[model samples]
Every structure is written in C-alpha cells, then in structure tokens.
Target: MSGCCGPAPDGRYSEIFDERFASSIARRYRRRGLTAPEGRIIEALSGLGLHGRSVLEVGGGVGELQLELLARGAAETVNLELSDAYEQQADELMRASGVDGRVTRIVGVDLAAASDADVARADYVLLHRVICCYPDFAGLLGAAADHARSAVVFSHPARNLFTRAVVAMSNARMAIVGHDYRGFVHSPEAMLGVLRAHGLALRTYERSKRWHIAVAVREPAGVRTAPAG
Candidate 1:
C-alpha cells in the first residue's frame, strides 16, 4: 500500500518543487536565518539525546538537520531526498562541513522503495514536515517502523481550527501567487493512529500553534511476558 505521494513519478521532484523553495532553504540555513518553525524542529530533535547513534533523515531538504545531527555526535547521518538539486547542494554542504565521511546523501529516490535491510540500518529516523505530504500515512509509518531500531521523530502542521484557517489562507495566497498548493492537513489523532497501527509507541509529543511534533519508539510484536508475578 503505497502513499498517494508515493514516488513522485520519476523518483524526483526538482522539476515540480519550486526552485525558489530550494534556494530559500539553502539561504536561510547557510545564513543562520531559519524561520521559527524550522528552528523549533532543530531544537526538538536536538533535545532527543541522540549521541553516537545512526540517523536517517527523510526528505532532508538542504541537509541542515543532518549537519546538526553530526555536530551533536551522531555516528553517521544518511539523508534521503527526492530532489537531485537538493542532493547536489547537500553534498556540497557536507564537503564544506569537514565531516564528509559521516554523511551519506541519497537523492532521486523515495523512502518506500528502499529495501527493509537498508532501512533497518538506522537507529533513528527523522521526518520533519514530511509526513503531511504523504497520502498513505499508514504505509509511511510502516516503512518508518521497519527502518527505525529505536525511534522515529516527525513534525507536521496540526489540524486544529486555527491551523486549518491558516492553511486555507496559505493556500489562497499560493494560488494568488501562481503556485500550486501542496500540503496535506490531518489531525493529531489521525497521525497517532497511523503510528499505533504500525507498532510504534508514542514517547513524547508537543504542539505549537499549527505544528504537532512527536517522538515514538518501535515496539516489536509477540514478546512473551510472565503472568503478573
């Protein structure tokens, strides 16, 4: 069961995703001018105590999180991106970071197509503002669970009255600007259900204005327990 936004036709979306977004992402992070929402995501993951662990960053736009994770002592960081342009930029950033050996950039691919063995190599998986774009939340969670040995952390727009209003306004604005809207809005309850069905237990979560962020641990099936002794 692949998601509606499964593979973006040709394993890449550079042609569709506005070049301005990529440029904006690079400029903001490079100049240390990330927006409040972006900064919050970085802070949230930083607080996850991820030292000496392997991390896989899905849809890692410009490799900002990967770079930060490496600086925070992650053993290795793998960035899976769906844009060749971003991948090239990420490679350049990794080279400039002097931590090239600690980072691997995989571009022009979707996470769903990755083999279970390849996905299972990570100790932690990060999906920042990426899940909402996925049409099949269930499949996405299942894939994340198969890969993550310990945890999968994600952040997305919260589906509240206020946030819904914001999204509507944003969509209208995008339409006025001649850009196609590309956000998938869902409530936190729906998000949690997806995780639960995939065998992930929520460990911590937080909500801010329109954003809902959570960290979940993977729970394997069929562990025998002694009778309440």
Candidate 2:
C-alpha cells in the first residue's frame, strides 16, 4: 500500500510511501516482477484466471498488481489507494502497459471503513504489503474478507522478535517526526481469526524473511468454517 501525508487520516503513511518508497518500488517493478514476498503472492493468484471477475486491490501502491491480474483475464479491476503521489507514476506505468483504461483508482478513502454498497465484493482482493501499514488488524482483515466474493490475499510483516524491534524503531522515528503514521507486527493467528469470523477459510500460507503471505477463501454455504490448526 502506498502511504501518504497531505492532510488525510494517517496521511503520514502517504508521505512515507510516496516520497520515500514509491519511485524506487515502481522502478523495481518496471525492471522486474514483484519483490520476493509479493512475487510469491502473484504466483498464488496467477493460476486463478479472472475471466469475467471483478478484482479489488486495497492500498495498491504503484498499481502494478491490478494490471497483472487484468492482463490475466480479469474483467475489471479497482484500486483503493491512500496516497496520490504514486498517481502520476502509476498512471505512466499503466499507460505503458496498455492497461490504462482497465483500472479504476479511488484515492483518499479508507477501505477498512468501506461499506458493501460503496464497494462491491470482488472475486479477488489483494492487500500486498498492506497489513503492516494499518493500525487495526482485525478491522482491516475482516473488511477485506467481507469485500471478497471468493478470495482475499494479503502481505504483512512476519511476526518475530527482530521484526518487532525494527517496527519499534520505525514507529519511534515517526513519533520523533510527529507523524501519526506507525507500523505494526500483528499476530498471524489473530488475523486469520478475523477472516474466519467473516466466513473466509485460510487456504494458503507462505512466508519470507521479512514478509508473510496468506490467502483466505470464502467457503461454500454449508461448509463454511475455518480450517483447524
């Protein structure tokens, strides 16, 4: 997710994501595919064709993932973003890929608070690197599950001592700068529980040194229940 800081709630995230990371992240995407953990996420979803399916990418950073999904046969894709700095660069990338019109970008909205009527449930929902960006893990995960017609996939910082230490340092910097933007290292089991409450079952799990990937699928009506650990 691209973070921002121009007078919006948690705008500091936008500032950090845009001014500090968007350009470099965009450049990396243009040269390669997604970064390691994100690449793993793409691999998981690529096998699932989007034919006539609606896809929503929450906190889509440079807008690369949505295009990839669209090109793979997704009917239409929507991006809910927090920052505008990535707008121009993302637009350029979309144009260059010839998928400029395939996406709908909504800026400055909190997807966690998004209503079902406001944002229709999608066949697939992605939150690549988004969890660490949000303060409320359960709300965000639950909302993503509710908004997903079939599956919801997300990337978050791996929960561990080292990761916690790093996040603590990052939060300290944000505080020192007087920014409300902060990072979190949430428990994977608790996050899974939130999705379970929303009727999604954990289906796939993968992890790297810094990031972890999890996919939750909306179960069949009669068989709706989370898998036992």
Candidate 3:
C-alpha cells in the first residue's frame, strides 16, 4: 500500500534489510542445532491443521518459511515482501529449493497500498518478525487479520527487562555505527487488543527469552467445526 512518509535520511538499514544476512544465521538453524525457533513455528502451525491449505507470509524474508510450508504440505505458498532485493533473494531461494512453481512472490512498495484481495486470498497468514518494523502497528495487524481466513501466526520481541536492555544496547550500537535502530518492542497486552478488535481469537501463545510467539484464529462465519462424537 502507498502512503506519504519522510524519506529515510540514510539508507543503510534499508540496504541491510534488503540484502541477505550471509549464510551463517541461516545455517545456524538448519545445521548448527538451532532449530528451536523453527520448531516453535512448526508446532504452532501444526496445531492449526494447515494440510492442503493456502498460506500467505507477509514480509517473509528470503522465503524460508514459504519453502518450509510447501515442504510440510501447504497446497501453495505466497510471499509478500517490501524489498525488491529481498524479493529477488526469495525467488532465488525458491528456485534453489526447486519449489519455484509452488510459491508466489509479490513485492509491495508500501504496506498501506496492499489490497483486500491480497489479504483475503489466504487460509493462513504468517507475520514473522515483520510487525516490529512497521510504524503503524495497528494498521499492519488489522490488515493481516483482514486477509487471513483461518489464522495468523507471528513472532516478535517481548517487553521485559532483558528485552529493554537489548533494545538499549542495539540503539547504542546503531548510533555508534551511524545507523538507525530498527527494532520495535510492543507489549503482549497491546498486541492482543489489536487482534481482538479485528475479531481474531488467540489460540496459542508462548515466550522464549526476549521473543514472543502467538497464533490467532480468525472468527469467520464458516469456520465452525463438526461436533465431537
């Protein structure tokens, strides 16, 4: 979606957000015994029963989760990214994984410019580490919920002493390095309020160190389950 905002004074953060963060962090989860975060995502999603469903991942960097969802039996995966550079990386990753045909990539120039059609086409939507970057947190959350027919899965930094310390350190380091601090820390309660206003019911939630993960199910009219035997 398109909106007017002051141009970023320096583009270093934008550049870093667009570029791939080397292979080290990616490999850490894949080969270095650091699968807990991925495991957390998998477990949360599995609980929602995503087999044969269409999934949309907003701001899915490099399309890692898109590949994983396709592999895990999601019928199709769509990636909506804000950066052309990252979108290219996502395309490359899909091609390298040999799943290009199963994924769709859309580069959104602005979040506010996204459409209802974009939001309404998915049975499931994921927002991993994306909301924290948005200046309008409520708008982003509402848009995500509006588009999801079934559920929205997300992970972000929690509000706590340790997390506050980390944010302070990050701000200090960014100042030292002539870069903008790119982190957004929100309280769990405030986030829940935004979801509730959009008619999404929280299904599951967890906290890991400074990170918080949550899955919220959309309460549409047609989503009722059959009665138990």
Per-residue accuracy of model 2 over 46-107 as CA lDDT, tens digit each: 75656788888988877888777777778778887777767777878888888877777777
> Whole-model Cα lDDT per candidate?
0.70, 0.79, 0.69
Question: Per-candidate TM vs. native?
Answer: 0.79, 0.91, 0.80
Native-to-model Cα distance after best TM-score fit, residue 100 in candidate 1, in Å: 1.7
lDDT at 163 for candidate 2? 91
Which portions of model 3 show Cα errors greater than 4 Å? 1-13, 20-34, 117-120, 172-181, 220-229
Per-residue C-alpha lDDT of model 1 across residues 1-229, encoded as one tens digit per residue: 0112223434224644545777778877888746676676667667766788888888888778878777877888877766555654565677788777887766555676667644445888888888876666666766776688887888888776776677678668766777653456766677777666666778778878756788877776763222212
User: What's the CA error at residue 210 for candidate 3, in Å?
Assistant: 3.1
- Among these predictions, the greatest lDDT belongs to 2
Given candidate 3, what's the lDDT at residue 179?
76
Alpha carbon deviation, residue 145, candidate 3 (Å)? 0.4
Q: CA lDDT of 53 in candidate 3?
A: 90
Query: In every candidate, how many clashes are there?
Result: 0, 8, 6
Output the TM-score of candidate 3: 0.80
Query: Could you tell me how far off, in angstroms, the CA of residue 184 lies in candidate 2 after the best superposition?
Result: 0.2
Instruction: Tell me model 2's lDDT, rounded to 2 decimals.
Output: 0.79
